[model samples]
Target: PPATARPAPAPAARLAGIWQQLAAQNTEIADLTAIKNHFERVLAGRTWGDPVLLHGDLTLRNVLVQADGGVAVLDTDLALTGPAAYDLGFLDASLDFIDRWQVLSRGRLYDDAGLGLARMALRDGYDAGGAADDVALCRALRLLQRAAELGEHVQRTRPALARVLIPRLIHPYFLAAAARALGVG
Candidate 1:
């Protein structure tokens, strides 16, 4: 074979892509105002086969490397009854974003960049142990969440991170998901 790849679309990739499709459709300014409510509603209604407690916003910064090589998590702000693996995906995405977005000139973390890194790290930790198969779906949903948040911050000016955070954390995350879901990548 010229190149070897599976003929079937990975379950995880398809899962990740759904959020990207949702994000692209919700590009309008209204999605932000309605997003948090949507997530809450969807989460409350849906249940997966492996449903378990989840940290809604698990990321690298939340996870602590223990002296004995164990991982610990903090920040239950995003916790819900959902996929634990998805939580790990968020962490992994955070790590990747941080590594890519760091600016030596400022010698400090930027808004989206730092947040991305935190997300990537969480996912990486999870995927590394085989969750990689389904990590894409979680990443996609993350971006959709970001787009919604951005819209809200745009009009209200509360989060104040609409441009910086959403672009860094949400856009690429969803795009990555889209690629996986559509098999463009």
Candidate 2:
């Protein structure tokens, strides 16, 4: 089996702080500027009601199925107090974009029916009618956050990759998908 790309999880609170800092200090990157402003607009006058401890990243790669028919969750670095829908949105988006990543594509779980079933199962497992609104918001937020993190990662470790990653894909995708979802565009 190929190794999973489970990047270190930074808490939602920390991410918010970083977003603020970036907005204040880093005005040179056009993508970051657009994303920050979009999120600011999308989140304006909105409040996350009662944040709870979330697994943060709940993709299939982070789950372990044991011989005893039990499951073990790994990669807790991104765990934090946030809307529970954050986890759900990440899982759902993982399904929607599974084909986008090499390792995830290997799982071959990108079917729409499968994704719908998985989301249904998730709602049932949580015994909630589904946090529809928060899920939508979190889905957009998570996408933007992931793109931002990837941009930072490439900038720090693989500076050359930034030229191809930032404006070309990450930034645009994040801005479009998130802004569209949030009706901010």
> Candidate 2, which ten residues in sequence have the lowest lDDT sum?
1-10
lDDT of each residue in 1-185, candidate 2, tens digit only: 11232323333554486576334323255555565666666566666544455566788666554434344568977666555677777776665553247334555634444445555666554335224356766666667666667677777888877777766776677667766655664
Q: All predictions: root-mean-square deviation over Cα?
A: 12.1, 7.1
lDDT agreement with native, every candidate: 0.48, 0.59
lDDT of candidate 2 vs native? 0.59
Quote each prediction's TM-score.
0.48, 0.64
Error of 2 at 150 (Å): 1.2
Worst 10 residues of 1 by lDDT: 1-10
Error of 2 at 28 (Å): 6.6
TM-score attained by model 2: 0.64
